[model samples]
Target: MSGPVDAELARVVRDHAGRLAASLVHLVGDFSAAEDLVQEAIEAAVRTWPVEGIPERPDAWLYTVARRRGLDVLRREKRHREKLTGVSWPTEPEPDDRLRLIFTCCHPALPRAAQVALTLRVVCGLTTAQIAKALVVRESAVARRITRAKQKISDAAIPYRIPGPDELPARLDEVLTVIYLLFNEGYLSSGGDRAQSRDLTDDAEFLAALLHRLMPTEPEVAGLLSLIRLHRARAAARFDENDEIVQLQRQDRSLWDHAAIAEAGRSIARAASYRRPGPYQLQAAIAACHAEAPSWEDTDWTQIAVLYDMLVHLAASPVTALHRAIALRYVQGPAEALAAVDELESSLAEYHLWHATRAELLRELGRRDDAQQADARALALTANPAERSLLRERLNWT
Candidate 1:
């Protein structure tokens, strides 16, 4: 409740809630019960942290408290205590356990919407109200969806263990989907002035690293890790000294993390060694083409266009088509790219990036008036402060 304690509480929720919930799930083998225990531990923090001062290891402290609470609940339930007794006390779960936890939370057995909502709540540490706001649904609707997801997990008796090697491929895709969405939400950011959330991006990178360690032979895992590292290597340059969006061509190369870029290169090589390429591998290859290039004009757009062509075949989405069009600009010229953009107009009409890309292509064609209108539409559709600022600056260009 006090200022310092409140900030600490927020930090703990954002940073450690998922790990704590993962530990509890392993111990209690119940989704709803573990979640409740974590909430109780947080509430206890609110009351006690202010009085006792924050502990040295806040996450460890929360985990200990929540585990104790979960045990108490199991004992008090009388009937469930038999089930709980069979469940051995979980030792400290490794970082990879959180991946398993999220995979289970987003299990394909659940409805797709519930999978996303539950993953955001239990694994991403988003409050129901926050999830509701992000999802543009009523708070109560989000609450019920999460509740239903928990019920499904409980009823279906979804085990809280990572998939075996045989099942890893299928389950890994679900885990990657959750992490990809989490990272993108932080990378471009959904609706904030800050271009990225360090917490979400860092968490995503951590998950990717854990996945890589657990399944080093999996090409897709290596690809996803490389993709994340490549983007993170440019995190510093994405925003300017004023925290505004910096166009890729204008970003200071000196500010980019060359070390991270090198690591990404290594990851890409690891992925290639597997020789079973996936969408993430193709996407990372495109990112590598940019990372290796010295300047925008010097970038190997042809190679990137080829990779995007591969990516489009692997995962044919409007977003991928839009990105492929961007790469087409250098390989086939702006007219070709503009035609590609126009083809997606109906599908991505409300998508801000579609209009933004259209504006760029139109600008190249000397249609300044049409470009300005496209830029305005982009600025109108997006709520992200960084994006809006970039569009406004583009619109003001002569």
Candidate 2:
């Protein structure tokens, strides 16, 4: 029961909400008040814009309405009267407000879950229900986490600006982790009907580039960019013409983006020159090895395995070990890789990839029946539609 005007308004509001909110927070120095103003502006738009027709500058209209609303509140409160006189509202958000907002939301003071939820809500402009769906958590839990995070920010008076150079390295890493996770989710969506969603990955890449421009000297920043670019380079060949997932070995490398791959190489070289062997740096190096290969058989699996060894040593996680096992399968042999995977059975019991890996190894060893069982187990454990389809195809082949 809405017209074109209403639909346009909704699109504009969703696209610009985070930037508007961030600008409001910077101007008013209050997170809760800024969010409230934005909600009020949206309400006003819904009530009036559809009938009046949409404005040419919708973002400016929203910001002006929110600023006026803030001014009205301050005018009525005697204590905030002087503060209102000093305010200078911008016609649009500053170029860096979104980035600053992300850093503030991902502050180390907040719990990791709260940090992620807050960033997705306040910086990504996702609704609680949308975030809950993406995270596979209850809506109530997401709401509570966001509420507590905002309350903590208010109570602690967390500054609404980017940290200085001395603190930037540590804080930037946290921000990078969140962005990369967002990209990964988009790259291989866990629950959506489609295999990929370009919107999330596009946003993440935009943010990553922004961070690199802001802190060009940080090696990990370059490394993160390198990692993302390398993945993006191969995006064209990830799925077949039928939209079915294509295995890496079967993908047509000619479909890859040569320019992006070359840029990734430059980024990796720059990161290496800094002499900081971080997890991202090592991972990028591994990715570079694959990008540089002319064909699957030409890949330097030995170098990749060595890089994973370094990565596992730096950050000992089940995921890293799993990746290392994959590299081992290429360099050492099916038997050695199978042994490594077996050792992780207890730790990765519910993880679909573990079973999938085991199935591949078993298939290589000519244990067709065992491989079929492992593929069935993997299909059961995974919720992703694309992954399920791949597993089903493999199972049928067995």
Candidate 3:
């Protein structure tokens, strides 16, 4: 492929693959087959785009290829054609294609782990490795969960549409998990060379907003949307002019969008009025503490730590524990936080942030050599370019 065509094709695929896959699944009536059709569409682009030049409407072009291929596959299978006889090629995009796909993937027939893994793969365009990292599980486990979930969908004939109102609550948590992880990937990107991808965050926020509109009384939806907006409000201050990671303590508060923060505050207040606090609301409350702070030193660590404690009681996980340890550092001191972080080594040893947090605490305790070694482990474990750069600077390797 020529350089320009290759670059453009990559961008198109990165930005639209999830939506394209969602549409194809709707047309094909099979999750696994839709994914294969998407791959075939990409392969077709690889073969033709360089020769023909990238299409003026690359996403549309890919969708057209995938749709035609899906029809061909159904025709070849013969018996399946009867099942989809009423389906026709859509003249315009469905506004909720991705959301419907997420709901389908999160059907209660599937296990919670499978629901999360499959939705992250097909609805959020996350790779198995990325999903594994997000879930703190093995990559092989994530792949198997995705495969089994797809098979279960096919066997059970799960309809590729949003659930009716009564069924929505049953599947809401899994859908929210997928969207939260999607936003996290965008906020600090796990797989790509770039530090962050605004496109992923924008997609996540769009989905959350759609969910909020669909379930206006759902506090967790409001909480998730508020959490995302709070982070986005400070996005401009996350990196320096050279695009190096800027620690939150050192970021220029003037760069933050105060109006956006205010809007998110109202969202949190709205969520609280529901009087049904959940993990997401607690997490958003914690983020609100950070976003509302006048400076890092003025951060309400006591309140943040209390919120984390509530979160742990509601939904404990290794990642949550690690975050709580950071808050503990600010609340109690390095000694106490180190003990908490140390207890998580067995559970989160493979997680880069675990080592990174340990390094911070070790540095604070005057264990310079141990701190350097922990930072080295973090550097080795992570593929994220920005994180690797930050770790290198910490180790004085830059």
Candidate 4:
């Protein structure tokens, strides 16, 4: 049903869709219209590229087609005609279109929920289904939120540019949220063929670094950068040679990047110097606790639990609570942690990690059948290959 050309096109689209959409939005000044132009260009490619073979610069070809279509739309609508004269085919030294677009989407005028949904959709190139899973909501709810958010952007005529210095602080929280979610998606990958995607994580790190460069005084930006680096430093130890998930406590400490971990520690110190504590800063501190530990048994669970307590005070959510419960498992005991986790069941019944965590606690409590059932539920809910493999092994189904 498909050919090499189709496969190549898919790969190109998958790799460059966010950059292309950002460029189109920059040209057309409409998020929804830019997306429509991209779809139209993709359709045109589907029809033409098969016969012509792939272009030497397929991304450029798609952008050219989409730009021309956007121009035509502008002419027909007779709106933003001024943008028509200023727009040209992009060349080298182009602005950071994706970053600018992220700021635009994270405007304070829009609801915070809509801001994150739109950025994840338009800037991160996540599908509605993927975003729904990440947000722990129904697909229909995600679709509606995205549609309304786009409409609100169009209606409000939000400028497609980065906010000024005076505006950055007001918009920083949502922007940080979007980037954090982007990194989280890459770290564990809510749903996809791969267990993880370095591309998404790399993109998030690049964006965070750029933000740090732009606002050097912003501690939260540094905190976020540190958080990402700390996680990436330990990434190599997260999986074994068999590609199965390796629990943090059981991972080889030798595989960890000590230099990067130390560098991240300095970043946390820098963020702390600002004395403007926030959720990201606290999270980075928690991650630093793990990264700085010489051994699993050397881990300072008390400090981690205290940090989680502070994080909960700043940003309370079911997921955050679940994570706090996990830290408590070491500080307190499995039974206490089990009680905390059980309270979240009604809220996190569909979440794979929640089930997986419960299985661990149940096993600790010597409830064999309950642990098996929970592991089975976790395997059913998750699409991640590594996690599924780990769960299967735990259930002795390997």
Question: Candidate 3 regions off by >4 Å?
Answer: 1-99, 108-152, 161-170, 190-192, 195-198
Clashes of 2: 0
User: Model 1 — which ten-residue stretch has the worst lDDT?
Assistant: 190-199
State how far residue 394 of model 2 sits from its true place (Å): 0.9
Error of 2 at 53 (Å): 11
lDDT for every model? 0.78, 0.78, 0.78, 0.78
Error of 2 at 334 (Å): 1.2
> How displaced is residue 298 in candidate 3, in Å?
1.3
RMSD of 4: 5.6
Per-candidate TM-score against the hidden true structure = 0.83, 0.83, 0.71, 0.70
Q: Per-residue lDDT for 85-121 in model 3, tens only?
A: 5554443547577677778877878887787667656
Encode model 2's per-residue lDDT on 1-398: one tens digit a residue.
13455345645655677778877777667777776677667667666777887777767787778778877877776544455456654436666787788788889988888877777666555556656766668989998998888898889987777889899878988898887787787678622364322245655666677678767888888888788889888988887766677888898999999988998898888878989879888888998899889999899999999999999899888878988998898888999999999999888989999999999999999998999888999999998777888899888877
* Model 2, runs deviating above 4 Å: 1-19, 38-59, 72-75, 78-100, 127-141, 156-169, 190-198
Clashing pairs in 1: none
Greater-TM-score candidate between 2 and 3: 2
Instruction: Give the Å error, residue 19, model 1.
Output: 5.4
RMSD of every prediction: 3.9, 4.2, 5.6, 5.6
The TM-score of predicted model 2 comes to: 0.83
